[model samples]
Target: MYYVNQNQINKRLEFLNWLVETIPESLENKPESDKAILFLAQERILHLALESVTDIGSYIIDGFLMRDASSYEDIIEILHGEKVFPSHLLETLLGLVKMRKKLVQEYFHLDRNEIYPLLHELPTTLSEFSNSISNYLKHELNT
Candidate 1:
């Protein structure tokens, strides 16, 4: 049997919940005068949400003695392999992981046109991710 840190996972989930709720408002209320600030805010929100997903995945992988993840992509692959989330989301999650990398590494050069569509889609993706994690935890840990 493996140990899972339910409390830690729960805390991350709670934060994700907040991010999910905030995404719609943030995207909807982007002011013409504050476009730069709104862009940064959107980027930060995406970064935080992606980070939380990886953090939670790391926690579960570590707790369950899953093979070591060599990269963020590996973390998502492992979770998918374990059936923690649906197969349909595998590609989307991988894309998000890549976006996370770009957000961190190439923040100065990101094209707003490219990112705007993603910002619009993020809330649904995050909601699905959060639900998957919750369900996986409940089923695996009997919580």
Candidate 2:
């Protein structure tokens, strides 16, 4: 059997993550809607992670911690491939963020310039998120 090293795996994960973050975010206003779309995209990435890697490090797959290759792969395929998130999850996330924005706004607040950091970091953050999932997949798959 062939074995993969962690460094090579890390590099691949990094590349995959970079690919994810570069996806366009051209939808209008609706911060919550944007966040919802981003979240769904992240979820889709996670599905790939599970399918692509072994995930021995207890990576959370759809809220459940997955330990084995089979469970991870199953969850990943179910989630990542072929339009998994559908419309419902997007609706739910958008609704929650929209309805609760007042409450969320009260506790977690950001100023105009302060928010800039997140905006500037958006690409990198999404990239890191993808990398994390890719790493999880690589570790689990041991390929």
lDDT per residue for candidate 1 within 1-143, as digits (tens), equals 98888889889989988898888776776559988888888888878877998999999899889999999899999999999888887876786677876799999888767667776777777788889999988888786
The lDDT for every candidate, in the order shown, is 0.84, 0.39
Candidate 2: segments with Cα more than 4 A from true spot: 1-103, 107-110
Checking candidate 1 for backbone clashes, the offending pairs are: none
Clashes of 1: 0
TM-score of 1: 0.92
Q: For residue 4, give model 1's deviation from the true position in Å.
A: 0.9
lDDT of 1 at 59: 93
Q: Alpha carbon lDDT of residue 80, candidate 1?
A: 93
State the lDDT of candidate 2 residue by residue for 1-143, as single tens digits. 32335455465556555544543442224477577565444434433333323231223342233223354334334433322233333332222223222323442342223232333433444454454455545555654
